[model samples]
Target: MTLGTSTSPLHYYDVSSVDGFNLQVSMVPVGGGVGCGVTGCETDLNICSPSTFE
Candidate 1:
């Protein structure tokens, strides 16, 4: 995602799990201003640790 314009209102975003991931993900940018920031993968990944999915 990419957005900028409206006199330079900018926000570029990316969140991926390389085609696989189970649950827990986030991005919050409400009332954006002054470096609108928040992005995440609050890990649960189906109880990860099976060799970290190789």
Candidate 2:
């Protein structure tokens, strides 16, 4: 899991499968935020990227 910060109007991410074979990705925005300032941000983004050899 990794956290990324961007102020750009548009953001793009490239998620590739193992060894750039599958190129699949799972993305979603964070929830609640509660007291934190981050009310809208991609959270728990999982990219089960794996190498084809593996």
Per-model TM-score versus the true fold: 0.34, 0.23
Show model 1 residue runs off by greater than 4 Å: 1-10, 19-35, 48-54
Instruction: List the global CA lDDT of all models.
Output: 0.78, 0.40
Residues 1-54, candidate 2: write the lDDT tens digits. Answer: 334457543434444443534343455545624432322223332444244344
lDDT of model 1, residue 39: 83
Decoy 1 TM-score against native: 0.34
TM-score winner: 1
Write one digit per residue (lDDT tens) for candidate 1, span 1-54. Answer: 788789876668888877757666789988888877888888877676586585
RMSD (Cα, Å) for all candidates, in order, is: 6.8, 10.1
What is the alpha-carbon lDDT for the whole of candidate 2? 0.40
Error of 1 at 47 (Å): 3.6
